[model samples]
Target: MKKEASAKTWNTLRNITLVIILFIFIRYLFDEDPFNDRIGWSVLILFWTFKGLFDAVEDKRSGNKKSMVANIVFVIAGLGILLWQGIQFFLYK
Candidate 1:
């Protein structure tokens, strides 16, 4: 019972942290500054890349093929976006 409760508490904390980070990332993405845009988007992409990869492994271990594949795709897309971000700066900036 204690272990279950502790796990729940940790899950709650983790979820809260995710939400806060997401909020900050969104703000950064929407800001007027070009650097802010890059930083914001990078934060989200890095988060998605790392979290998706980690979750993919965890899902695979738990035999959740559907979720595992989804995570893998997410990681791929995040990497793609990061690559694009590296190549060019928009004229608007």
Candidate 2:
């Protein structure tokens, strides 16, 4: 029961973080100098990447195969996107 409650709390936090990241990304799309916000964006992406990985671990512990797989995919995709963005920022800067 306690483990389930902890998992729920983490899930809620991850969801909220995802929403905030999305809003910041949308705002970045409209900003005049996107590169100026690279640090903020990088931090958000790193947070999201770690959150997904932690969720994957929780899902594995709970024997939730489907969710575990989904979280793993999210983590990989997030990292890939972050790396791509970092390269772009470095190359252009």
Candidate 3:
């Protein structure tokens, strides 16, 4: 139980940090005014992260495999978005 809690905490923190970094890079490094765009992207990230976590927890409660593959796919998608945004910032700057 404790181990599972720790893993959950870690995943949440990691997702949050990635979101923050993506926001920062877009705001400062890119120097592009993505005010509304930033908000939308942030919301999307938050939604996906929370949804994945909830699904995982529900699966666990039901004695399933916790949807590990789906969770990982979402995480990877989030990271890929950040990377693409970062590269666009660099390339355009």
- Largest TM-score belongs to which candidate? 2
Error of 2 at 46 (Å): 1.3
Judged by lDDT, which candidate is best?
A: 2
Q: Which lDDT value does model 2 have at 40? A: 65
How well does model 3 score by local distance difference test? 0.65
TM-score of predicted structure 1 = 0.57
Residue 70 displacement (Å), model 2:
0.5
Provide the lDDT at 56 for model 2.
92
- Per-candidate TM equals 0.57, 0.61, 0.42
* Whole-model lDDT values for every prediction: 0.80, 0.81, 0.65
How large an RMSD does model 2 have? 4.1
lDDT of 1 by residue, 1-93 (tens): 997897678567666766777888999999888778778978787777867886787688679999999999999999998877766655444
Order of candidate numbers by TM-score, starting with the best: 2, 1, 3
As for candidate 1, its clashing pairs are none
Evaluated against the true structure, the overall lDDT of model 1 is: 0.80
